[model samples]
Target: MLMKTIFKLLAVALLFASCDDVEPTIYNGNIGQNDTFLSFSRSVYLLPVVQNQTGEVKVVFNSSTVSDVDRVYNIEVGFPEASPANPETFTVPASVTIPAGEYQGSFTIPGVDNGLVDEVVKRFTLTVTNLSDNEYMDNDTTTINIYEVCPLQADFLGTYTIQVASEPLGISAFEAGEVTLVEGDSQYERVFNATVYPGYGGNQQVTLAFACNFLNLGQSIDTNVTCDVEDDTKSLVHAPAELADRSAYDTNDDSYFELTFIEDSQSDCGSPANTVLTFTKVE
Candidate 1:
């Protein structure tokens, strides 16, 4: 009986020793030590309707957590003022998923070419919400603007009849002929380039360049002149300092170009200290 009692006591001591050798499991609510927040890849994006019909909005995690399961996120759309585009204009997904091992996810926003032009610029805002896990934080909301490619107040791309309404140079009244206003080069938009006769009896032809702001009908006509007389090409005039008076006006489906420039000191052409070149769009 004494030996049996000793054996039982030794067994209990071995059980307590085994329990002390094993480490206790500590439960931590956070998967990683660092904090993670969801953010949009870009705050603003231009939706190209011609080249790329769709725009992508990516949801990225600033810092990724050691997540065992896929993280899901919900997006909400809001219109600050009057909505320019309806809900039908965009194809927004209900939710986006960040894969188990991935830190980024994206959804596509499609642009519809409905031939509708909005007088005012339209925008829609997107925000991230309803995160699958409460451990992550939500960052800033993104705004997407949708508008048609309407540049000018009126169609100003065509031929125009350029004439010097008043020239102090005392040169004969010349028929400048039809000066074709072509679209500007790739570098410029809403700008036109043309070679017109600004001299007497169609004698001197000069390169004309002009541009108009699409948002506002503000116009700027270039007064720099390249005169090529008798196969001798030289820059006769340079752009003036003050162009506040120069402007363009569109009336009755006809655009008028009213330009005035001060000639530089290097100019050999006398008189007409302030050159005024006018243009009437040809029908």
Candidate 2:
């Protein structure tokens, strides 16, 4: 009878302890937010289709975290590169969600005139509080990189007209039929290259190099009319009255006369020398 009573008393004590160990109800408690929260995935953006000559960069926002958050809060984007030399721009949205949700807004990037922009994202952490008691809550961070693209240009490409042997060249024997310049399959930047080829020396077999630069054009082209041996014996051909000048032939030298239109003297023609001449232009 005594052992039975002792066992019954121990049982009653254990029942009361178990009943008192039950947890209390959390009736809309402010201390219920005791979990770990973190936000990542920040990126820079280059807005395309922007044709601003001043080299200003426009950025776009992608905030997809707040909607999954448990508390009612507000998130704002800011730049740390703020204050006289390193000031940042941070414009907040008009309102915050009483129950916390994702939000967005836009503002211009100012004071950057150097055409080079390396923008860093400045994020403002959203704080949560009890609707009844405005208490501080936990926070998270994110970032973005904004930049500008420069323009490019290549070189000068075009065409030009050319002329070789343009002004004139003097060949003592042959007549200058034509004066023309040909590019010869190769494309030259300049229309006329007076130094490239020393072309058209009508001497020998007609294959002369273009090594010379200066050109000689005859002012007057005519024929030396020899009076068929009879005029040579009479010596009536080289009279100063018939020709233009006496200097056409230098009696002091035995070389042939190389005369221009303005230099012709009626005294230059003799029955012993008869030859026809022609002329043209080359640039």
lDDT tens digits by residue: candidate 1, 161-226: 767665443431234456665542211122333332233121222323233321221122222232
lDDT for model 2, please: 0.24
Give me the runs in candidate 2 sitting further than 4 Å from their true place.
1-72, 76-139, 150-283
Candidate 2 lDDT over residue span 80-109, tens digit each: 443112223222343234233432223233
RMSD of each: 29.4, 45.0
- Model 1 residue 270 distance off true place after TM-score fit, in angstroms: 43
TM-score of each: 0.38, 0.20
Q: Candidate 1: which stretches are off by over 4 Å?
A: 1-30, 51-63, 117-120, 132-140, 150-283
Please report, as a residue range, the 10-residue window in candidate 2 with the lowest summed lDDT: 1-10
Highest TM-score against the true fold, candidate: 1
